[model samples]
Target: MNSTTINLPTPLELMIDLSDDQFFDLCHKNRDFQFERTASGILVIMSPTGGETSNRNIELSYQLQAWSRQNNLGKAFDSSGGFKLPNGAVREAWATPIRSPDASWIQSERWESLTQEQREKFLPLCPDFVVELRSASDCAERTGEANRLKTLQDKMKEYQENGAKLGWLIDPKTKQVEVYRSGQEVEILENPTLLSGESILPGFVLYLTVIW
Candidate 1:
């Protein structure tokens, strides 16, 4: 939470601008990569994760989805789901900074409030609970301004600023988790064996055995 940087992927940033529909078409055309445009209009590209990251990510996603199903408390999503944070800085259909956290959940009431058409597209608001699982590649050493760890950290802050109630930035490599919540400083847990969803997720708990 203090002044620190966690660098993420060395993204390929293109200066070109695309409309919402245009970006959607580009995303579909290059389905293998992740395309994101920052609010300032910088287009970034992230590649598909490696196998180990994929495996760990599924565990996170599966556990969250299963918990949401049992509790009937919210809708859970995998990394493929995109969210359009309500920054009010961009147009409606194609918003700036389309984010796809590794695992995310929206409270049931909020989930149900969206119209079917709205639900089918990038979610128009930040999630109540979100998780970003860091992989080895994401933390690989890079020179200059490329910092994968800082990238996700900034993302966590962005989620909080955009109205996320709680977020966990988990790093399997270090067995550490940075907990972010509204109106609170970041909490760092070292080699924690488990994580509680706390009030945001009610009784949901995530055991780190498989992930670690």
Candidate 2:
């Protein structure tokens, strides 16, 4: 991960140095707030998702979980699961090695390859699949803010750069979805009723009615 500055409008940032253990402990201690870090070790405090967004997130997770169980192709993770990116500098210098996607899935083979200790810590690899939902605070219409949406778009690009096979940036307010695939242009779907997993997931298809 490269060190870059992101000028956030809210939930002020504080630059701090904490080891992985320290950071993990801090997260548990302050369970009420969401936190993220940059590759340069700047700690970001994320606001909680609103009720509507939270509900939609639950549905999204449920669908991914159901499909994962039936297919047994990979493991599904919720918003709480933090992962350590593989392409990064040493943790001592930059503690921004961890990130938590709203929803993610890792192929079974890659998951099985992790040591128990590594798995217990922040997962040391990018997931095969990732999803980013635009909450009320993130929606352009709701807040009249483009930064949040742009931030998410940048995140999707980061995921692709870091080796994620596929990603989805779902914007509920606009009923639009931006599909990200490795080495390809982003495909935007307007008011999509269903999203096909394509070659990445083969037969898996996500119905958007519940989300809408």
Candidate 3:
């Protein structure tokens, strides 16, 4: 993985950082670069290309948003927000050690409780739901899903512990979703006919046809 270390300055120093236009220009110059903010600092991310997998992930994100709106599930986002952990630590969407999931959800009340800085950072209190879309860039063939799954599973546990209700890991090639609950055993939905869950988004049913 490629990485770089950025020195974080004080809040006042942050004011002297790149202007908004400069930021956008920088981003435009680097297709691999992604920008996100958190309570701690701003983040710039670069990752290997995932080609078709990236497109499929994006499609799923739009579908999820439509489903959320249709079901009145508050709001949904695709790699677009940070997260405020229970410890008051804020994490940027792109700064997460792991790749950002395709989509995430948070209830209205939690959304409203954030501070302006937190809001600007757009950090979720705890996502009521999360979805990770598997990609060819994933080290599935070598490390397999064990390590990745464990990491995601741990994150799901953290979210659930912090009040999140559900999580999903979607593998496009297999057309499957692995559902994770805090205490319950993981459930695998192979070639699911429908994506339905009441805990996270009540009365929502996303058919498989859209995905496959």
Candidate 4:
């Protein structure tokens, strides 16, 4: 008797033919596959899927919303707010990327003035604050957790270098958060008290305790 093995196509391979907009829509429709655009091309990242990350993200979103409302910071979002970078035109977060962040925040000025089509096509502007939560599926390989962290770091650097006020990288595994402030060194916080700037969120204090 002879046995045969069948090969399966990866999601990225299946999506190679789609335009950027169509690709984004497809990912949104599926509600899986954390997605993002890189310097190279569009990527459909695969990660261990579960509810823990989602729950944490929801919690973070609520915190941000409360902070925003209390401080009049305009609006905050999770992975939903896509940003336009200097190099590339648009970059949106994936729905369930390997290492999904808990929440992101955008300043009021960025959201209020839209170019009509821009509001419909992409996120109004780059957010003032970004937060990423580590997951069990996060690991280091070609398409593993390590790569995800690197990609996220690069993107955060890009945003900060451009005009973003601050960014946060949360690693639940390590119980630590890496804070990125424009024109300053990346600070690792085990339990930091620093809050977001008035230029960004005014009176909002991003408590790392909530994330850890």
Candidate 5:
């Protein structure tokens, strides 16, 4: 008798630029893989998260989803949800980047305002709250964005700048969470067991043990 093992694939980064329609079509055609387009149009091809990462992600998403259900104020998203971020005021009018935070939430009003067709496509708005988990293996690498490169921390800043009311960058390896908010300095919390949603997500809190 023979048993075969399967391997999890790593993301492949490409320098090619794709138009919005082309990118959206690629995502629609390839349902099994995840894709991200930077503001400069560099495409990132991603595979599903490995076991440990997926377990951690689901816990985080579950907490947010439960809170969202009770409050009825917003929608919670798992890792597969995509968002189109608005351009920063300080930069030239560049192509908007579409990103998928590990776990995210959009206010009910904002989500409801979109037309059915708009809702069916890559969301044309940033999530009100975003969370990114930096797996132990992702510590050393940064991804390219045209000429600029970004680490997970940089992605948190991008979320804040792109109108996310709150963002958290969680690193399980160090047991630290970096908090980002509009008009506020990034707050670094070390080994914090709980995270507050503050005014932006009133009455929501996350217990971190499940993530660690």
Candidate 6:
């Protein structure tokens, strides 16, 4: 048996700028792939997750969704959801970039404020909370893992800078979690069995049994 496939053009890194509409259209044209645009209009192509990584991601998203539905406080989003940032000169006066987290949540009030079109497109606002899970690719080599850890740490900082109240970088390989929050120091939890959502989530507790 053979699987059907489309012959995509050879991937290339071009420096041409793209308007928000053009970028959105580009994303729509290639929905099968993951795309991220940086503040400088540099496009990043992300590979799809492997089976183990996808399984772990689903578990995380499911946990967040259940919690959100029960509390009725926010909306949970999976890896496919993207958010537009407010920095850069990509789109004239409305310069911005796009990013997606492995899992995220936006507060009810903030989410409700968005128009139907905004909700359907890349969210124009940052999520209230975000989570990044480390996959096998992130820890395949000692040097690479160290560099990836730094990048993840930086990403958590970026989330805080962009208005995320809380964030977590969970590394199954090291069995550790790095917590990030606005106006607080980064907290490292080693081999933690559970993670508390603090005042931001108010009664939410993330158990790490399935994650590990």
Candidate closest to the true structure, highest TM-score: 1
lDDT of each: 0.84, 0.83, 0.60, 0.61, 0.82, 0.82
lDDT of model 2 at position 115: 94
Clashes by residue pair, model 4: 34-96, 34-97, 35-94, 101-132, 139-145, 139-146
Model 6, 61-166: lDDT tens per residue? 9988889899999899999898997553233423476878899998999988999999989999878999999888677674366877786676677777778899
Q: Which regions of candidate 6 are displaced past 4 Å? A: 1-16, 88-95
Model 2, which residues run further than 4 Å from truth? 1-10, 88-95, 140-144
Cα displacement (angstroms), candidate 4, residue 115, comes to 3.7
On lDDT, the stronger of 2 and 4 is 2
Pull out the clashing pairs in model 6.
none
Q: Which candidate has the top score in lDDT?
A: 1
Query: Candidate 4, residue 95: CA error in Å?
Result: 20
How does model 5 score by TM-score? 0.87
Residue pairs of candidate 2 with colliding backbone atoms: none
Clash pairs, candidate 1, are: 6-149, 6-150, 7-147, 7-148, 7-149, 7-150, 8-147, 8-148, 8-149
Q: Which pairs clash (backbone N, Cα, C closer than 3 Å) in model 5?
A: none
Clash counts for the predictions, in order: 9, 0, 0, 6, 0, 0
TM-score preference between candidates 3 and 4, better one: 4
lDDT (Cα, tens digit) per residue for candidate 2, span 64-176: 89988999998999998887776552334445456788999999999999999988877888888999998877764644568778878977877887788899999988999
Q: How far out, in Å, is residue 175 in model 3? A: 3.2
lDDT of model 5 at position 89: 41
Per-residue error for 157 in candidate 5, Å, reads: 1.2
Stretches of candidate 1 off by over 4 Å are 1-10, 88-95, 143-146
